[model samples]
Target chain A: MKIGYLGPEASFTHHAVKGAFSDEEHVPYTTIPDCLEGLITAQIDRAVVPLENALEGSVPITVDYLYHDADVHITAELVSPIQQHLMVHPENESRWEDVGRILSHSHAIAQCHKYLYYRFRGRALETSTSTAAAAKYVSEHPEENSAAIGNSLAAHTYGLKIVEHNIHDYHFNHTRFVVLSRNPILDELRLESEAEKTTLMVTLPSDDRPGNLHQVLSAFSWRQLNLSKIESRPLKTGLGNYFFIIDVEQSFEGVLIKGAIDELEALGCTVKVLGSYKKYSIVQK
Target chain B: MKIGYLGPEASFTHHAVKGAFSDEEHVPYTTIPDCLEGLITAQIDRAVVPLENALEGSVPITVDYLYHDADVHITAELVSPIQQHLMVHPENESRWEDVGRILSHSHAIAQCHKYLYYRFRGRALETSTSTAAAAKYVSEHPEENSAAIGNSLAAHTYGLKIVEHNIHDYHFNHTRFVVLSRNPILDELRLESEAEKTTLMVTLPSDDRPGNLHQVLSAFSWRQLNLSKIESRPLKTGLGNYFFIIDVEQSFEGVLIKGAIDELEALGCTVKVLGSYKKYSIVQK
Candidate 1:
């Protein structure tokens, strides 16, 4: 099997693909859209993309692409603990005060905002396409006055030295990754004990009448079906227009899920099922 | 009266403040947290900040700051149509092919992703703190090879010329700004004809029992109260924990609003009224 992930290798998505599908041949795509497109074109059998972060909330591009741009289905979910480290070129030994610039992906920079601001007060901050790419740039340039924030895997991959370990501001930072495929997972591949989650894209009635969304929620609420998450995204039509992406803690095989959809459609909501899959978590020590 | 807004001047927030409070003396704060801090310190009588955008969804910093950091109340709402333009230094005559780099805020860059990828493919894209800041940088540098994506006001403020108008990927781009004050607006100062919107910060029952959120929504649904918006934000305590920010389409004066709160509290939810205020829209032609 082949897997595609957002990369320049050693990125969090790369780690996710490695952790989830050991021994699989993996290729790195430059962007999230590229990974999805690769899956659609059969350049790869599956794609692992970050869906959300514990601290940053949702990844809008991933959500937006799944909702509007792609015909892919999420087959499985994986969670990985994010550990950001400050790295330098292997041959360069510069004191902390000698550092003139810092580089990382925007989110990594944001996650380490306080540490960076206090330690490297006047240093120039730059964003790269990925954390691994930042590490690669630092490694290739061999600048004594520059450092990169990335993972240990990136340090290993790019032949860089880890100057500081776990520099991320928050300790509980974790990113959720979803495995996407052109076709849904077959029943034979399903794990019986794995927890199921069904994602739905729902558009409420256009009128701002009282109880429109409430009516939609009532369909699941009254059925005792648990909703794990609910997010509102703009329909891109205009202001004040939105559609809700809901994740229910149940599979699509049951009557309850079907009944909820039936009730919602009756109440004038257009519903589309994005996926029904088993949730998985990979804990990195 | 004095007002505070996020600025480096000619920013959307600056425009929002200018449009909404034409007679008030407006001061610029460097960041959203600074604006909120100004309110807490009584440094300004009111502050206007972006709350949400039509294309991008919620402004997380503004929402998170309001919910967690400060005790300020939202007194009014303003909507502004966002128009992004490709701008260059007037003296630097540059054709589209001559542009080697583009600069803007991350959101602005993301908004113009399609246009930039197609027209200025492989160009170096950099992010600044604000779109206006990007324009200022481009103006001061006066490089023929560099341009900026910003608003028309930014072009005027920075003495730059618009190379292309409406360069944003989507047409219906709008930003929603909120007027925040330390003290609630007095009844005498309230406009009777203005439409009301009450924003609420709600924490559903901590236990993940089925129907907890549904029950909370049912409180308003049964009262036939209209909920204009519902957004779920991470509580930051841990993953999978969230609190909802709901905006109702009515003021807090009546029995229905009060009844909804009472019902929610009875159902083991903590509710905080963030504001009850008039809605304002500034249309740019």
Candidate 2:
């Protein structure tokens, strides 16, 4: 199966896709939308995109995209442990203190916030592509006035120095990535027994009234269906409302959940099922 | 008061800091950590750091740094609307069709996820510092195969063309930024009349340990304290615990909140009072 992910190869999304598919060759996309397009046009069999970073929270694009398409299905999930590093040009070793700036993706910079504060004190920090791009920049410049914080592979590829290692403030930092595909893989993967997830995107009516959200959330609680995550995204249709994405531990085909779906659809609102697949566990990482 | 915010000028964070302190001049910071350092050393009277994007979720560093000094206090908060643009070097506009790559901050790249997919089917997408940085990069390396998706100001500054504009999936994309300082600002500001916010940072003993989270949340629910936010940050001291950054509708100094604080502290967990400032409604641009 061909898989799509954001990449220049060493990106965390790439690692996540790699982690999810042990032996499958993955196609690289420059953006998440491209990955989505690949799924829509049948260019790829599956695509993996980040849904939420433990530190960064839920990615709205993933939510919005799911809201945009009713057919896109989430087949599996993966979580990548975010480990940021400081990579600098090897030629600028002794002059490291001369480094006046640091470059990385915004999230990378944000992930290692405390370390940059304590270590760099007052230095210019710019955002760039994957840590690999940051390392590439430092390698091309080879100036002590700049450095980049990224992954270990970035340092090796660009011949950069590992000035600092795993510098993220939180030791348990991790990001969750979701796999999307055009055709629903739930039925095919169900035989594996490990497949145990169902994600749904539901849009409620535009009236700002009481007990609306309670009614929606109760649909799951009443069925004893464990809700994993719930996030809202604007419909952007100027409808003055939002769509909610809910992840349940059990498949939607289950009788109790199917009954809950009926109750939700009967609320005089729009509810669309996104996908059902096996829960990608961290223990598998 | 001298305030620090991520920017060169006209950056989203720059606009946010201006919104936070309309009458004050804010010094531009190249990175979020530099802004945090400025707050730690009193290099600036206060610093504005984007904590969470309504559409994108939390900015990890802002949460991690709350536990840095235990002395740094969040004196105020504000939210700014974000509208991403697709800009390119002016001289390279005729090559739009030939462009094989696009660049911007990862979040910017994510926000314009669908737009990129619909527009460029098989192009390489890259990341940079804000959209402006992407514009700057395209300006420096004017290749027919590259374009940048960012802010309009960046395109103007770098003599880039607006290949596309307002491509973010969500129309109401707003980010919440917090004003932080070394010593808490006890002096009432002109906005005191509108001040109705209470921010607190509490270190929980552990994660998902039944009563730990329930107890802390109950403090607010029991006292009828309207909690606006509850963010989790991994406590870095190897205690295998986490901290909860909670924002309520009432001032921390209020008598009602005082009782809540006592009840929260009695649970054998550490709670640091962050700030109690006037909350202002965010006006979307």
Candidate 3:
């Protein structure tokens, strides 16, 4: 299967694509829109995008893209622990205080929130995608006292040294990525336990249109479907437009899920079932 | 009064401050942390920060700040129409297509989502805060083809011309900014209007613990107090930390509001009433 992912080769999205399909042919796109376009045009069989970062919250573009293209279905999902490493030139003997600026993906900067403020103090921290890009920036701008926060893989790819390792505030810092495809994959990877988590996307008519949301939530509440997260993204194509992404801990086969979806459809709005994935289980400390 | 606002100057936060207290001394800070620091150090009387944008959703940082700082009260609020303008240096003759890159604040890029795809299709749009800052980069790096999205004032300040006007997708796009101060300004703003809005910072015991949120919401649900927003932010200095910022449509005087607060406090978690203020009305479209 040919899989498309957002990247300059080794982004988190690229890693997500690899995690989803091992032997799949990887097609890279510079922008999420291009990756989406490829998916719509059938240039690739499936695509992966970061849905939410523990640090940055929701990926707005990814949510917007899924809403715009109704045909795509999220077939699989994964939450990878994001371990951020600070990389700098090997010969550069710059103290942490001397560093004028640091760079990483915006999410990385957010994950390293406490550490950045405590260690770097008042220095300016900028953002880019893959840690590899930040490493590249550090290499090219060697004269400036700068560093990058990314995975250790980025340091190796761009020939930078690890100034600091695991700078994220939380060890459980994980990014949840989802796989989207035109056709649903039967017998997709699942735990021995049946998948209990399901995701859906819906566009609300208004942002502050008074208890309009309460009405939508009541459909789920009435049926006793537990909502995990409800995120809203502005609809890019139209004014005052928004897409609400909801996650519930229930199966589509159940009465609650079906009834909720039926009520939503009855409201004369579009609702797409993204996928059902078993929530990740980590051994307790 | 001296007012602190989030900025490097000419930022939306600055504009918000101007809208609320035109006669107050405006102090600009580069980051939200800096603004908080200014407040702590008494560098300014109060600060205005974008808490929520009607288009892009919540300003997590501002929300987090209010959540962490128990002493800070939201004294006043203002919601302003946010219209973005494409700006280019006056001396440069770069056509829209000729521009290799577009630069503006991240939120600005998000606001013009439709226009970027439809009008300036394929051009790489980067993120910065001030449009004047983008123009400055273009001015210094004359060979690079870049334009910026900013207010008309920024275009004039940076000696840039308006390439396109009002590029936001939403005709009624607005961002709500909250004025925070060390001491409560409730009594002062109350003379203008008796109806007040209060914002509070809440730290839930667990993010994923089942029914914990329901119990919290039940407080307000039982009393029928209208909740305007429920926003979250990562705690800046704490263990396993996250902050929940909530906006309610009524003052603490209402029995419902007090009951909700009493229940929230009974949960053995931190509940800080940031401040109560006269709810500012948005200009009619």
Instruction: Specify the highest-TM-score model's number.
Output: 1
Best by lDDT: 1
> How do all the candidates rank in terms of DockQ, highest first?
1, 2, 3
The per-candidate TM-score of the B chain, in the order shown, comes to 0.90, 0.82, 0.80
Give DockQ per model, in order: 0.35, 0.24, 0.19
TM, every model: 0.81, 0.75, 0.79
Q: Write the per-residue lDDT of candidate 1 for residues A1-285, one digit (tens) a residue.
A: 998987657878787777777778999865566577789889999988877652222266677778777898888888777788998886665564577788886557766756776788667877665687788889888745588998877888898888888887657656778888898772223222357889999998888677778778878988899887887777778766888989899998889999999888888889988888887766553
Residue pairs in candidate 3 whose N, alpha carbon or C atoms collide under 3 angstroms: B73-B274, B74-B274, B74-B275
Say which prediction, candidate 1 or candidate 3, comes out ahead on DockQ: 1
- Give me the displacement of residue B157 in model 1, in angstroms: 4.0
The residue ranges of model 1 lying beyond 4 angstroms of the native Cα positions read: A1-15, A21-49, A53-58, A82-170, A186-194, B1-11, B14-18, B21-49, B53-58, B89-94, B97-109, B114-147, B185-194
Q: Clashing residue pairs in candidate 1, if any? A: none
On the 0 to 100 scale, the lDDT of residue A146 in model 3 is 87
lDDT of each: 0.77, 0.67, 0.66
Encode model 2's per-residue lDDT on B121-177: one tens digit a residue.
Answer: 557866554666677778898755478876555676678888666888777666667
What docking grade applies to model 2? acceptable
lDDT of 2 at B4: 88
